[model samples]
Target: MIVAVRRSLRRALLVAGRDLTVERRQPDGLVAALTFTVTLIFVESLAVGPVEARRPVIAAALFWIALLFAAILGATRSLERELEDDALDGILLLAGGRDALFAGKTLALAATLGIVALAGGSLALVLFDLTVALPFHLVLGVALGVIALPPVVVLDTLLALRLRARALLVPILALPVLVPQLVAATQGTAAALSGDAAASLGWSGMLLAFAIAYTGIGLTIVPAAIE
Candidate 1:
C-alpha cells in the first residue's frame, strides 16, 4: 500500500511538473496575471489615496480580489493550454484515474496561485506602505487566504472546461462561491491591521473551516469533472 501510494504521488507530481514546465516555456499566463494584479493594486491605491488610511479595510479586499481574478485567469489559461495542445485527452488516457489527474492539476493550480499571491502581497505592502499592527496575524491571515484559494480555483477550472462564455462564467460562478473565504480573509486582515489578535484568530478559524470544507468537496467533485 505504501509503494502504491508513493507511485500515485509520483505520477501526480509528474503531471504537475509538466504543467509547470509548460508555463515556464511560454510564461505569458504568469506575466498576464502579475500585470493584472499590479495594475489593479495601482488603481485601488490611487483611488484610496494612501495605504495608511485605507489599509485596514482595503488591504484584505484588495488581496483577495486580485488573487480571485488572477486565479480565474490563470486557471482558465492553464486548462485551455492543455486543451489547445490536445494534451488533456492524452493525459486522461494515460492516467487511468480521474482522481489522480485532479490531484495533479489541483496541485499545479495551487502552486501557481501561491506564486501570484506572494508577488501581489509583497507589492501591495510596499506600494501601499501598509503599517498594520500584529504583523504575525497579518501574515497569518494572508497565508490562510493563499492556502484557501487554489482548490476553489481548481474546482472553477473544472467547471469552466467546455463551457460557453467561460471567462465571464468563471467569475460569476466562482466569486459567489468564494464569498465565505473572502469574508473570513477580509475580517482577519482587518483585525490584524488594527492589532486585534482575538478578532484575527476568530476570522482565521473561520477561514480554516472554509478551507477544510472546500478541500473535502473538491476532492470528491473534481475527480468526476476530470473524467
Candidate 2:
C-alpha cells in the first residue's frame, strides 16, 4: 500500500512537473495572474482608503474575490494552454488513467493558487492594515481555502476546455459552482477577523467537505471529458 501510494504520488508529481516546466518556459501565465491580483487589491485599497479597507467585513469579501478571480484566470489559462498544444490529450493517453491526469492537473493548479493566495493575503495585510486577533484561525482559514482550489479548478477546467467562449464560460460555470467555497472562505475569514473560533471551525468543516465532494466528482467526470 505504501509503495502504491508512493507510485501514485510520483505519477501525479510527474504530471505536475510537466506543468511547472511549461510555466517556467513561458512565464506569462504566472505574471498575468499575479499582476491581476495585485492590481485589484491596490485599486480596492485606493478606492476604499486604507483606513476603511481595514474593516473586517469588507476585507474578507475583498480577499475572497481577489483570490477567486485570480484563480479563475490562472486555471483557465493553464487548461487552455494544454488544449491549445493538444498536450492534455497526450497526457491522457500517456498517463493511462484519467483520474491520475485530473489529480496531477488539479495539484498543479492548486499549487499555483496557493502561491497567489499567499501573495494576496500578504498584500491585504499590508495595504489594508487588517487586524485580526485570531492569527491561528486566520491562517487556518486561508490554508483550507487554498486546499479547496484543486478540485474546483479540475472541474472548471474540464468544463471550459471545449467551450467556445471560455473566458465568459469559465466565470459563469465556476462562480456558481464555487459559491459554497467562497461563502465558507469568507465566513471563516470573517470569523477569524472577529476572533471567533467556533465560527471559523464550522466553516472549515464545510470547506473540507466541499473539497472532498468536488474532487470526487471531478475525478469521476474526467474520464468522460478526456474521451
Candidate 3:
C-alpha cells in the first residue's frame, strides 16, 4: 500500500509537470484567468461602493466571487482544450492510469487558481481598504479557499465532459457541492476581519476538512468517471 501510494504521488507529479509545461507553452488559460480576476476585483469594488466602509462580509464576498470565477475559467479552459483537441485520450494513454491523470490535472488547476486568488486578493484588499484586525486569518482563509475549491472544479469538469453536458452545467453541478466551501471561506474571512475567534476556528476547521475530503474524492472518483 505504501509503495502504491508513493507511485501514485510520483505519477501525479509527473502528470502535473507535463500539464504545467503545456500551460507555459500556450498560456491562454493563465492569461484569461488573471484578466478575469483583476476585472472582477475592480468592477466588484465599484459595485460594493467603498470596500472598507461596507459591511465586513463585503470583502469576503468580493474576494470569493473573483476567485471562484477565476478558478472556473481556468478549469473550463483546461478541459475544453483537451476535448477539442482530443488530447484527453492521449493523456490517459500516456499517463498509464486514470488516478495519475486526475492528480496532475487537479494540481495544475489548483496552482493556476491559487496564483490568481493570491494576486487578486492582495489587489482587492488595497482597492477596497479591506483592512482586517486579523490579517493572518484573512490570508489563511484565501489559502484554504484555493486548496479546497480546485478539486471540486476539476472533478465536475471531468464529469460534465464524460456526460457530454453543456459547459453551463459545470457550475450548476459544482455550485451546490461547493456551498460548504464557499460559505466557510467567506465567513472565515469575515470572522477574521471582525476578530471573532469562535467563528474563525469553526470555519477554519471546515475549510481544512473539506479540502481533504474533496481532494480524496477527486482521486477516488475521477478515475471511475474516466473508466
lDDT of each: 0.78, 0.81, 0.81
lDDT of 2 by residue, 114-146 (tens): 888889889888888777889999888888897
Clashing residue pairs in candidate 3, if any?
A: none
Residue 36, candidate 1: how far off, in angstroms?
A: 0.6
After the best TM-score superposition of candidate 3, give how far the Cα of residue 168 lies from its true spot, in angstroms. Answer: 1.2
Using all chains and alpha carbons, the TM-scores for the candidates as numbered come to: 0.88, 0.91, 0.91
Cα lDDT tens digits for candidate 3, 29-125: 9889999988987887787688342566887877887788777788888888778768888777764567887777888887888778878877877
> In model 3, which range of ten residues has the least summed lDDT?
47-56
As a TM-score, model 2 comes out at 0.91
Query: How well is each residue in 37-121 modelled by candidate 1, as lDDT tens digits?
Result: 8888778777777834366778768877887788788888888887886777787777545555666776777777778888988
Per-candidate clash tally: 0, 0, 0
In model 1, what lDDT does residue 71 have? 78
